[model samples]
Target: MNEQHILEQRTPQAGRLLIGLYPARYRDLHSEDIAATFAEATEGLNGRALLREHLDLASHALRLRLRIASTDPAGRMLAGTAPVALALAAGECLSGLLPSLTALATTSPQARPRLFAVEVVLVALVFIPWIVALLLTATGRWRRARPVAVLAALIDLGVALVVLGAYDRAPGALLRACALAALVLLAPPDLVDTGRRGRWEAVAVALATGVPLAVLMDSRVTLLGWSWYEVPAMVGFWALLVVSLLLLVHLSARRPDRLRALGIALGPAPWLLEYGIGATHWVVAYFVVLIGGAVAVGGVVHLVRRMLGAEPA
Candidate 1:
């Protein structure tokens, strides 16, 4: 039999589904060639091996469609930011889950069956997809996670809007949530390895996200209880602190590319959306001062490094 026939035999139905994920423009030009190549490569693979290849292929296809698989600095920047975005989504799920569990514990389902049922469904809709996506990304299957994350974000946005309209809550929290969800959806898929460093980075991100989120959720003043309007500013401050510490650590260790560092900085910056887009103007000047201070400090740092010959002029 010819190679085409052989390829047809090897390509499973799921493989065709992956190829179909490609854009129509690209598929029209090269789907057959791509499919045939994939089939030939996986001709003898089966079971877990085949599934692994399928996931890898799916990730490649997603990166292509998202236009984020390039080796260029922009692509690298997005790749760096994407994993953090997933971690933040996981953090949000954790944050929301706490209140949900509390409500379940305090409220009797038999006393208010309909209300309890609705709450359960809402929690499932808004949070489960994010947790699932986080699990997938943690396992290094980011391409498959992206679509699931997107679904989670949509559910979050929808629920936020409903809560805003029905309960008349301050839009600040909802808007910030929407902004963070948007960031998670737009970020490219992260290409992570099952390595020690990758595992550590994952843990660090989870801590960063969880710590700030927990602080914000606190209701007691001694524990950092701040109003919803204050959340953005608090998150922004935490992000800046983390960035400063990272910069200092890098100075003593191996320095990262400035551009990639900037991208990493952005992973913690969704809070800026509150003042900028959500119009929580009370914290506007606070961010301005923080930004100005950062710029001035960076200038001094660069000048000192140049004078000391630690960095290229």
Candidate 2:
């Protein structure tokens, strides 16, 4: 039989649908080739072999979609940031859950229902949309993802504001607000199509701006007396700092821009030192403070060079 006839006979309806799952541009470029390959691979296969073939096709389509998405700067940013966002969301949920559960268990029966209801709403507000947006972004659904992410950020900011009000500008509240605001700012809009370098630069700007604000707002006086909740909160805070640092390193390597790398690196150092000092780790805090001072000076020098229209050394 001819190749066309063979392909038509071997390619199942499900295989066609799986291929269709890829973006239209991708399909336009590779659909025929992919279909032909599928037909050839599945030829004369039955039952388990056919099922495996179908699974392979679906997997290939998913990989193709992701590969296509990775080509876009916004998509890359979304992909890189999604994991961290989800991790933060999980941490927040856990933090809320522990206290809420304790309150529920301790409260009188009459108040238990009210506490449980409030906890449920709080959990929903804190987690659902953020998690959904991360999943959607991972799957290459940027248009649908953007609004969901924005809603999640708004909800998180509102919660942070309430915490700030109740606790008189708590560090945790400020950090939460800054983190969500950073995410909201970084979350790519479908309208503006920027390149990878542009996206990384945007990330650098967001971190450089947000990190200092968070650091300044962090009232470290209470760190001498640690609460159980502070453990998780500290872990989340350090995780964020580490991620931001790694991102800066990546951008510095990938792009030729040194100014952004310097700005981001310098901006967070003082904050880290302050955290160490607040936690009473003096040796480390002193060491970091020295390093931060040097980097800050270097950053200042770089800024001066830029002002003079000279390339940074």
Candidate 3:
């Protein structure tokens, strides 16, 4: 293009594009001033000045995006929620399956009345708190939600009292089972506290979970025409209880993997200990010693790492 066209078109238009990046209120008054400055500054430059202007504008937009993304709390909350969302997926799966099985077993003619009582109790237990908490949430009473959970749990205790009024046929097995489920639903693992208190909390939940699992296994063994092995079934139920308790101990001590490792170690540690080389039940004692020693060593390593600030400073 010619000099008059170049001054009139290229420089002024290119400068206007740069000013467009600013908010409209800013550009409305300054656009023409910026265009004039550019027209004067680049008056003698060739075509390459246009390319330099575009590159500068693009870099500015990217910096603004990074600043906003990092500073927003909502963005951080979403990142945290991803792991919690995964945990909820697993919780929901168990909830759906357990309730369905309980529902199915309760449908039989003999099982119906007992199951109905259980459902009534469970419905009261689960729905009442869920409703009250929901209502409080709707009215912006979120600060009171934890207290509401406690109060809701108390009301469910009243439901258990109502169940006691009937007292039919040696406590009606299904009702007992459903009551157990309601207790589980009312106070899930999520409600438990963290740290020192968390240890006991973990143990209690493990005990409660173990009982129902044992009962379910007992019932399963009876149902699948395994009655001939009734003795073995009861023995197996007890075995599971012991294993679960051991698991609970490991969890309480903050060594879940240690519990699994204990089993793996049991197979190999006997030979390593040469059957403990002394004492009554010496082979069994070796496992207790090995697991305890390993955990102590791990704790020492952790402390050293913490002191060195190799963990988190």
Candidate 4:
């Protein structure tokens, strides 16, 4: 095909989508060069190459998007302070379960701290920001972005419910009733960006979700005997609790900016309370493991500070 013919076939929108992955600075200066390269490289490429190109494009785009999003005003406001809240919440809730590698791998006792440290960092970086954003928006910060957050929170809830059902049948070692509350509060609500009053809706959802999630955990103690698995039921229990809290926040949130600020701001209170309770248990029942766990937390904190380029938190 002639160069002119091929250029005529390409849409500007499609070109933009493909080029969106490059850094803004780079794109601003060299977009045509990059596009020309991609177009020439992709022309007559084999199927595998085409797939590879698609993925490469997507990966670069996502990298740029995240880099840009982290600095965007709204995104910063949502994540700047909230990730810490969600991280503490998940860490507090899952402290006991993280080290139990009773699955296929035979975990050495000496390696537990390192393993737990890795788990904490993964959970903090990958999961916390989006989850907290969902909660803040669904509960109160209704915007064009709210629907996406709400959908994700729902998926989080759905996964928890699935685990809850499994607990009903086979039983497992799992968290207590409070995990339901944690899951609920951590989620946003079901409403789209419809400017609906969400705080009360969230509250009702919380109460409703809480009762069943609690039942699931309690029954697991009876049905499945809450075995080694309870240590890792972190996800299900957290879902119920986060969703419930989101319900309440949806009903009560007065303003979006305030709500966004509050979502991150308020998460630590419950986390601190839970942490104190868990610490007491660790001291009394699992003193050595608890000490190791504390050490692990310190190590992980060091890692987070290093990775995020902040002082030792």
**Alpha-carbon lDDT, every model:** 0.63, 0.51, 0.39, 0.42
lDDT per residue for candidate 3 within 1-313, as digits (tens), equals: 3654554575656555555665566456654555555666666666545444443333233323333122344223222222121121122223334555565566664656786767666765544563454344334343343344334444534554565446432233233223322222222222222234333322333334334444544344454566523432232223223333433354344334442334322222212222223322544544455445555666666667769987652
Candidate 3 regions with alpha-carbon error over 4 angstroms: 1-101, 104-144, 164-218, 221-298, 304-313
Model 2, span 13-36: residue lDDT tens: 888888898879988787777889
Rank ordering of all candidates by lDDT, starting from the highest:
1, 2, 4, 3
Model 4 poorest 10 in a row by lDDT: 169-178
Query: Which one wins on TM-score?
Result: 1
TM-score ranking from best candidate downward? 1, 2, 4, 3
On the 0 to 100 scale, the lDDT of residue 159 in model 1 is: 72
Best by lDDT: 1
The alpha-carbon lDDT assigned to residue 147 of candidate 1 equals 64
The local distance difference test score of model 2 is 0.51
Please give the RMSD to the true structure for each candidate, in Å: 5.6, 13.6, 23.2, 18.0
Give the higher-lDDT candidate: 2 or 3. 2
Give each model a TM-score.
Answer: 0.65, 0.39, 0.25, 0.26
Poorest 10 consecutive residues by lDDT, candidate 2: 184-193
Clashes of each: 0, 0, 0, 42
lDDT of 4: 0.42
